[model samples]
Target: MKPQTRFNRRDFLQTATAATAAGVFIGTSSASHAQDSPNERPVFATIGLRNQGWTITDKSTKFADFAAFADVDANVLGMINEKLEKKTGKKAEGYKDYREVLDRKDIDAVMIAAPDHWHTKISVEAMLAGKDVYCEKPLTLTIDEGKLIEKIVKQTGRVFQVGTMQRTENQHRFLKAIALIREGRIGEIRKVTCGINGATGSPVIPAIDPPEGLDWDMWLGPAPKVPYRAGTEMRRGYGGGVPLHTNCHYAWRNWYETSGGQMNDWGAHHVDIATWALDASETGPNKVTPVSYSLPVEYKDGYPTVSDQYNSPTKFEIHVNMPGDIPMIITSEGDNGILFEGTKGRFFVNRGRLAGKPIEDLETNPLPEDAVEKVYGGAVSENHTANFIEGMRSREQPISDVWTHNRMLETCHLANIAIRLGRELNWDPTKREIIGDDEANSFLSRESRKGYEINM
Candidate 1:
């Protein structure tokens, strides 16, 4: 069945403004007016309409009205808008800049799937604008970004749901694993190993012009400007083609300027789950040590020395010492899953499956029906997006709240810093500072490109 568009962008924004000014009372309450009905629901806008962005927006249509959309690539924006309109008969206003979407008072929320560098800026702005935020995983490109977003969310009383959907989704796989650990089915967990796979790099490629319809400058956002290199010059398997060099779209995650590669990509999910199970969401690893690591290209003083090749670490074996003397090892070897080694039992879980002694015991001993719900803090939703929607209505935090999510991101960012520096680094979680190593501490945050700076 096709969903009907009830209000255009301008009309929706205008109506929302007056209603909010009068304290008309929407959100989780029954309203006498049809316009304010939960049936009409909240309206949302999406930024960065690429692969993941498209998927999220499409899925979100079932729960909210997508009033508008924005993307640096005009081609992506047009294509996604057309698809949304065709699929649901609800057309969204398109914008080349995300700021335009934030400028609208009608938008009740925004789904941010922009690159890692842009995540903090847009999320903070959206919150200050009084919009709930649903931002994709690996929440920030740096530790400071995570802290900034957390602070802004708290200050604004905004509901922020990070893309670590495993907490609410995963079909109860991660929740079950966490439940076992929390319920004492797994005797004290000695160590947890998360194998997050590896990164891909390309040979040096020459600078070239960005494709038509792409706003290259806006796409670069907060990252330093560099010459655009068409990825066609580079080998496919090693490094991807154009957009890879300039840190745009698909290739941005592999570069240090925009992302933390697999460390943050997969680390954000698995490491986040690990922290949740350990009840260490507020505090993170005290010591991070990189045993062995490899970068695709040379780097000088933490910056990639080369421009053309993929620069993130390709392989790494890192050991992190957590608060309770629990050692967590993050590596790129073995099946891509998290392995929990505990005194009584052990288990492994990824998106696909959760297995081991604990799971087998569950069949016989049988966990209470509330086992998974307990891990979810109450009820599990149909999916991660549903949790965000529920949080928006109740003004409560979703399963993956920004503060705890930031703690997980801190671990991932610190691991990346340690790998890049090729040494061990001590971290004071309480002070949120690096201990004794000024050089290492310098990597905790980065200066965003002018005009894109994250401001309170």
Candidate 2:
């Protein structure tokens, strides 16, 4: 099979709109009518019903019913089912395979909180099946998957929202701060430094059989097959099974095959903010050059490792040359915050504090009313899930729409690619191709295991 080439923005938009028009999008406003009038609730299903899935499910209860739940592990399914019964006073059907959930016509939308590898496949398939999707962050596992998902979202006209929740936070005043910068509050922007840490190392463990009621092959999905390692530490340090299993669920973020490490994990948040603030949400950096990078010398706890066992970079400095502006450095330090260097002075923001020269200026400087409206797309919802439900009804794009998300994912994935290639590379955003680097280009998409190809 030929490798898929990236689609241009215009093609993506046209495809998406057409898909929506072809009965793919049952507008959110109609969702209530579609359900209540017909003795149904806008039937919704959740994939990977674990940590994030439970939260999304709880929040979505107001707009839709939890019609179904799917997970690779039975233990996870049992736990979520018990919770669903306790909370909703109703039972939801459970399945081990996500594809089974997608096959249901009654399901109008799907909330995908699966690991990175399953995100693209589940989302693309859900859209293809005429369902809206709320996929978890770091939208795709690869740059190619990002472009592919962007195209699928547009082509299918399905309301798709990447789970970059920071965009929905009210206290993270960075949204308003970014509007100020774009509105010339901070003068010409000079540089943006995004602080994101790297991945941690996995503990060595012997190969073992798949855990009970877990479909290990399905969990592997499109990734290359490897023997199951018992008690092997995965990324993010969440144990797979045994209290001592130590890795697999939450910790999967440390592995390149399962996660984009800090580049994708934190990049989904901070890099997204930087791109939105810089008014570069529709595009990405022209160049990504790594000035410095270091792998974990020894697998000390807390710090990330660069061992081949984990694909994410541990310590690195990535210089990104934005279009028509000073280059920005995305590093693994600076207290994991966003620092903006402008001609007037510098402003820094993170999950907590927002500080800079004349720090009080942020509160008083106030972004123009029109700018805030534009940034939030007119309707402001305090909740991300609510925004998706609202967007589903209004037929308007959500906060983390596919187009903007692809651009953000591109930045993080390119940084990872540059680190992996160990060389500077030029990216042509319009063409959506890597210039003169076939080796780097090859990494854009991976071959699916079989029977999982994304088709238009």
Q: Where does candidate 2 stray beyond 4 Å?
A: 1-41, 170-172, 232-247, 296-308, 362-365, 368-371
Give me the overall lDDT of model 2.
Answer: 0.73
**For residues 10-81, what per-residue lDDT tens digits would candidate 2 score against the true structure?**
465455456457755432222323322434456789999878888888887887888899999999999999
Best by TM-score: 1
Q: What is the TM-score of each candidate against the true structure?
A: 0.90, 0.86
Per-residue lDDT, model 1, residue 202, is 76
The local distance difference test score of each candidate is 0.80, 0.73
Per-residue lDDT of candidate 1, residues 19-74 (tens digit): 55687633322222213345557888999888789878888888788989999888
